[model samples]
Target: MARAPKTPPIPPDARAVLGRFETRGPVRSRPMFGGHGVWCDDRFVAIVFRGVLYLKVDGETRPLFEAAGCSPFRMSADRPSRLAFYTLPAGVNAGSDDLEPWLDRALDAAST
Candidate 1:
């Protein structure tokens, strides 16, 4: 019997986007589609794709993301697949060190 090839591990740069969660709890970054699935404990909280970190959101906080000019994550579907996650704004990405609030929001949505 032949053994299957083992999948390559995710690169350090690709997974660096999830470093913030290390201190909070155990964070797992597994490859998903073209991105990585970020999980906090047992809940899916965020995703990192092409250097963009998207956080989970619910109906209540969706408007906030919109107001911040952050777009919801879209995937392939029969129509359009709008996921419950949104990208952080450019300003937030431009040297803004605080990500706790965003992480909090993601955890809240994932918890529910």
Candidate 2:
């Protein structure tokens, strides 16, 4: 049998996070597997899970995130799978101006 549809609206916290990207272009979210996928101008750039935002990272940007003490998004503690997304450094709010640089990088990475 097919799984039931997930049509729950984006949580308030997720909306607040995505709001920061609105200036970049059209920002939208879609619920997926208990989290929300964030898109900017139709480009998939980030994910909000458990209220934490993770931005897409490529080889060029992964080092930047790592140097900033960010960790990759793992499926679970028991799983070794790691995605290309990484969280911002501790205390960096998703809506803060500090996200400008990182956000630009993530958008660039997503474009590729």
Candidate 3:
């Protein structure tokens, strides 16, 4: 049997995370497994799932996020899932104080 469809409404906390997304293009958010995927233009730049915001990770940047105690994103709503995105450190909220530089790195990674 097939599973039910998921609604695409953006969550409030997810919206706040994107408020400081620092993008010039149109921003889009869609729900996925109780979290959110944030897109700028056509690029998949960020993810907010399970009440935690995650940034896109690449070869070099992956270590940084890890060093900061961030782990890869995983979802098991219907089944087990994992993605290239890494959870932003627990202390880094939508305010993005120390989160900005990390997000910038993520943006750079996504661009490349």
Candidate 4:
């Protein structure tokens, strides 16, 4: 049997963004490919990989990312596959200014 991978430690910056949500405290961390997934209420809300943070939003909330010029994280042999998440452009995820809106979208998605 294959052993489950271990989750990486949350980055201080990423943790700061996730801290804004009311449901943030109970987040579970787990390894996903080469990154870490943040889960709340058993649902994945975000991921941090290669020093970039990606927010998980469903179709309804997907447009917000599109508007920001963010793209789906495509996994290839040279890169980690994003699977069910979309990553914000570089520098955006780490900024508090850019972080809230995406986090809000994730929170909203989680609520529905």
Best by TM-score: 2
Clash totals in order? 0, 0, 0, 1
User: Candidates sorted by TM-score, descending order?
Assistant: 2, 3, 1, 4
Off by over 4 Å in 3: 1-9, 22-24, 77-82
Task: Please report, in order, the local distance difference test score of every candidate based on alpha carbons.
Answer: 0.72, 0.80, 0.75, 0.69
What tens digits encode model 4's per-residue C-alpha lDDT throughout 1-112? 9987665677887777666654454767777777787787676788787656777877798887777778666545577653656776567644457666777677667666
Every model's TM-score: 0.74, 0.82, 0.75, 0.67
Where does model 4 exceed 4 Å of error?
1-8, 22-25, 77-82, 89-98, 110-112
lDDT accuracy of residue 42 in candidate 4: 70
lDDT of 3 at 54: 76
User: Which wins on TM-score, candidate 3 or candidate 4?
Assistant: 3
- Model 1 agreement with the true structure over 10-109: per-residue lDDT tens digits: 4564356456666667988787767678898778988766656788899877787788888777764345456688987656642357556776777788
Residue 7, model 4: lDDT of: 54
Candidate 4 residue-wise lDDT at 110: 60
lDDT of 1: 0.72
Order of candidate numbers by lDDT, starting with the best: 2, 3, 1, 4
Model 4: pairs clashing at backbone N, Cα or C within 3 Å: 75-81
Which pairs of residues collide in candidate 2? Answer: none
